[model samples]
Target: MLFGAGAGMLAGLACGGGSGDDARPAVLAHIGHDVAAPAFATLHERAGALVAALEPLCAGPDATTLAAAQAAWSEERDAWSRVLPFGFGPLPPELNALDFWPVRVDTVETAVAGAPAAADAGYLGGLGVSAKGMPALEYLLWGEDPGAALTAFQSEDGARRCGYARALAVDIEARTDALATAWASEYADALATAGTGSAAYPSLKAGVDEVINKSIDACLTMVKGKLDNPLGNLSGAAEDPSLMESRFSGRTRADLQANLAGVWAVYHGADLDAPAAGISVLVAALDPALDERVRAQYARTVEVLVAVPEPLTEALVADRTAVQLARDELDTFRRLLKLDVASTLGVTLALSDNDGD
Candidate 1:
């Protein structure tokens, strides 16, 4: 679930305590109650809206209904993007079920051909990763064009596609609802109780370290998974467009922005509304100058992302300079995050073991 950026810098705020003050407990509480719980709530709500939006489209398969469903999908996806920064514990499994990309098209095709009785949660949940989730929905809704997809849904065999799409939405809704419940009830306590007489973590520092680890992973994903790999930086040619996140919808840029939003959420310790004590406060207390540098870097990264044109798949090929510029700027931010923020906070990043780009 962890991803990164949003507006309003979390820097420049004053801290009452000096470098020696330990605010990990407070930070964890704020993240659990204000940040993670609320993000899951929003995800559940938006997912519900998507399920409802898809109902009419599946039944009628018209352009108007298809458009409505697409809009709902974009909203739900943005909500999911904001939720990415907390992609730890239960979130990762749910994310794999919901947004795993480069979907196994053949698997999905086979499932649709079989035509299950209903697209209920159990049925969809039992299906393979590539055969279900948002990516599959993207394939169904945006295949060729909305109009053509709708026409296919109206054909003699259209019921099968409609059934699968409905099932996918229902499964997503179920997973999000389960996530919200788990975070609010079970995981939030574990996070809030981190470092204090807890078996899960030895110290409050451990909890904070988890946040740092996820944040760095989000930054790494931005630099490597999202941009460089797809752009073919190693091979000296852009890879297939299908490699890009949000490739079906051409909203990869928005996904990148949401990545930053997740980072912003963690940096600020809360979302825009609930600004409780966060890593920023700890960093400010320890080294205010370093804090300012990290914030400025975050702002610069957001600015670079803002400048990149939409439809990132095309941007990778035709507008290589713009994509490269954004990537370079994000790389700088990632380094600052690793060097200054993590160092000053006394945390270490555990880079992924899997070496493939």
Candidate 2:
């Protein structure tokens, strides 16, 4: 199932013929406009809402305001998860800024202690990645318990702590807004007109290759970075609950579910029944049987993930089998994309820095 083995098998398979070539422009257009653009828009909107919620809570640290802010953060986090498949364009540069995890509590606490009373964007800009993204905000909002988080906000350092959280939210909103604007104003054209005087891509094949390869990388991220690390698949030691994403809010399961949904959006479409021109169009045209298998495997993977109990930190200890089953299903999904679908599309798979065998 390694990519080296997949590349060897690809040498014997035929390239996706002229029809797939002809469909590239439409597919790119659909993905650019119908899929990526809207996803970023939602993320931007949700980030704005997060800022709004955080403002009132920072001004007055109360139970109701805290709940509202936490709910807003969850919504923004899910919106972000859905856009995880498209790692190109304006995403890569801002990825760490927007969602860096395994949050360093010491960094966040130190930053908060030294932050100005106002804690604006400039102050946040000077801080490191670990102290200012979604994870940091989750720690601030949820803490060890809702009561403790509220008590801290009402303590002598309450204003500084809340101000720092608000600053982080503001930074996230600005970044997401820039991402949405970039995709809509310029990057979409680069993708849609690829191979037709589009400087970003030399050929339609190259454009499609980027899309399929990113999808593969996203799957790999979910399988390894998100699931395997916490499950101790990489360390070959005891499961480490602290490695889980969204651990502070107990939303790790929701995050993984949203990630798989994002991958499915690329493989199928935004809609399953009436399908838009996602990579699925070219994939189905080039190899229908493989398409069906991918579709089925994706469903199986999501189903198993949903079955994993909530608060993935505890699940890693109590329900390790369910989590591992979900990971195995996701690995299979990644293999099908990296091996069969990429070969069918004649895509040149690019190596990702995070990729492992």
Candidate 3:
């Protein structure tokens, strides 16, 4: 609502709404950059894969047991494979359409309970009850019984049951991966089998298309992860500073600043061309004038995002629900650095758009 201010008015400028005018353009510029099509598309694709990958991490036990079980199940899978007559081995076309979410839950539950991560994992108390229990389950118990009403995934005793469930999930993952690998193999073999754009070109093209489209989806998710996603929905596990020390190590503040730069570049044009300078400016401004309390809150939030194990996806999908809220507040504090969008020719000019937003 107010606008007239200068460096000489710093004291009153900080106290009154005079700063809002300066802030508005900066915020808008940030929004434009943040939500730009290329950035958004890149992140959206990545987040989709990350959500699928990390969702299974907390399941339990370890990778070793899960692998063993999957190996055994593959033998059985062959039986299913042989009975089919379609291209690329015998997997149920109908089941393949069930989508990854179904398979994701199914697989993670299987791996965690079998070994390395946990002893048991289940939904609906493992009662096999399709109703009355929440559709998805995430629970971990340490030497305690959750009682009969709850689906129990016991380590030693329950391992037998949980192991099989875990195995089933691992089997599903393998089945899917196998399909991709087989397609790639065929593509590669065909490349040398014939001349360019020959009889096998169509087959190779199909495989390439499938993989590229899949990658594009990952990129789209990455954009979403950067701009959206939230902290609460990510993991139930509590923060562990020791783990943080192990993973990030040394200059925590610097690391945090780098993260800000990455996020900033997407929407704020925080100098992708000059990352260090952008991060330095952001950190300097953030530390002194911004509310320390709020800064600390945000700092912790970023910490969680970094630890997420998903690949090609930003670990921030959990925050998808709260992104609007964050953006609304962030709109107040957004800042930008001005730079020339120079033409390839030697001509240089100052555009009025130097909002320094």
Alpha-carbon RMSD, candidate 1: 6.4
Best by lDDT: 2
In order, candidate lDDTs are: 0.77, 0.86, 0.30
Residue-wise C-alpha lDDT for candidate 2, range 120-166, written one tens digit per residue: 98898788898988999999999966587899999999998999889
lDDT of 1 by residue, 73-109 (tens): 8888898888777878678876778887876667877
Model 1 spans > 4 angstroms off: 1-21, 235-237, 271-276, 354-357
Off by over 4 Å in 3: 1-99, 102-151, 155-157, 173-177, 190-214, 224-357
TM-score, each model?
Answer: 0.89, 0.93, 0.27
Residue 87's C-alpha lDDT in candidate 1?
75
C-alpha-based local distance difference test score of model 3: 0.30
lDDT minimum window of 10 residues, candidate 1: 5-14
Q: Which scores better on TM-score, 1 or 3?
A: 1
Clashes of each: 20, 0, 49
Which lDDT value does model 2 have at 119? Answer: 96
Q: Model 1: what TM-score?
A: 0.89
Of 1 and 2, the candidate ahead on TM-score is 2
